[model samples]
Target chain A: GAGVSQSPSNKVTEKGKDVELRCDPISGHTALYWYRQSLGQGLEFLIYFQGNSAPDKSGLPSDRFSAERTGGSVSTLTIQRTQQEDSAVYLCASSLEGGAPLHFGNGTRLTVT
Target chain B: DQQVKQNSPSLSVQEGRISILNCDYTNSMFDYFLWYKKYPAEGPTFLISISSIKDKNEDGRFTVFLNKSAKHLSLHIVPSQPGDSAVYFCAATPGGYNTDKLIFGTGTRLQVFP
Candidate 1:
């Protein structure tokens, strides 16, 4: 693909339900990241991956949040028992390597009702 | 507290004027800073970047100024155009080359009126 792509551009789920957001990064990109942006708020770092190394999950807000990058390409971010606070735009980005300029995707706007 | 801060939430400028957006960071470890432009419902696109080694970096109409001592950075768009109206984000990565973790700011919405 020419750039990073995310699926389900918009989502609305009842509170307590689980949601999975998907990301398809640019071909050959080894690094991927997930971030959450609330209404009128800055991006909140969630998780980062570099190759097969242990994902830097330190930024995950809580146990309900988790993400994984399979085969170093496609990635998924899952939120369990979603709450109203979880409603936000989930963004995905890919780069040749971590910390470099990233190519972003049109994020999934998840709204927890 | 915010690690990367864009103090001005919004700025309005006339077309053909200069649009100056500011960002401040507390971490001296940040060696690289980047600017991103975003339109409604779209992802942010990389605009320009500046490494800590240099104080200024310019790409055509966009220029970035970094003040290491003050921990401040500014983006200047000369002769701003109406098409330039969008939210601008400032990002900083602490580690050196090719790393991926970026601390981002709240973003500033720039409105360029024609």
Candidate 2:
């Protein structure tokens, strides 16, 4: 793809519902990252994937938040039992390698009603 | 606690004037710094970056200055353009080694008026 792409640009889910956000990274990108941002807030690290494996899941906020990247291309983030606090913009970025400048997607705005 | 802070929530500058955005970090271990520009309804774009070893880096109209002792960094735009009006975020990481997750500041909204 020309740039990083994320699906479901806007999502409105009810509390306690499960929502899956998808991200498709640029071709040949070796590093993928997930970040969450609240309105007027800074980006919060969620998880990082190097290749098809994720070595740094330390940033996941809770057990309900999980992500997996397969084939080092497409990634999915699943949040079980969504809460109002989870409402924010979920951003995905990919880079050629770690420590390189990232190419970001428009992001998925999830609103837990 | 917020490791990185951009105290100024908003900054207004006239076109063709210099625009300075400041950021401060409490974590001395952060050795890599970057500035990003973001417009509404879009993702942030990399603006400029500076390594800890160097105090300043210049790229065209953008320049980043880092003060290790003060744990501060500033981004300067020469002869700011109205098109540069957007939110600017300052981010830092420990180093360019493995496991360099960025920590970003709240961001400062830069409004350049013609």
| Alpha-carbon RMSD, each predicted model | 0.9, 1.3
Off by over 4 Å in 1: none
| Per-residue C-alpha lDDT of model 2 across residues B75-108, encoded as one tens digit per residue | 9999899999999999988865344478899999
Candidate 2 wrong stretches, greater than 4 Å: B97-99
lDDT of each: 0.93, 0.90
The DockQ of predicted model 2 stands at 0.67
How accurate locally is residue A88 in candidate 2, as Cα lDDT from 0 to 100? 96
What is the docking quality class of candidate 2? medium
The DockQ assigned to candidate 1 is: 0.77
What interface-residue Cα RMSD does candidate 1 give after superposition? 1.3
Task: Tell me the lDDT of model 2 at B16.
Answer: 99
Give the 10-residue window scoring lowest on summed lDDT in candidate 2 chain B: B94-103
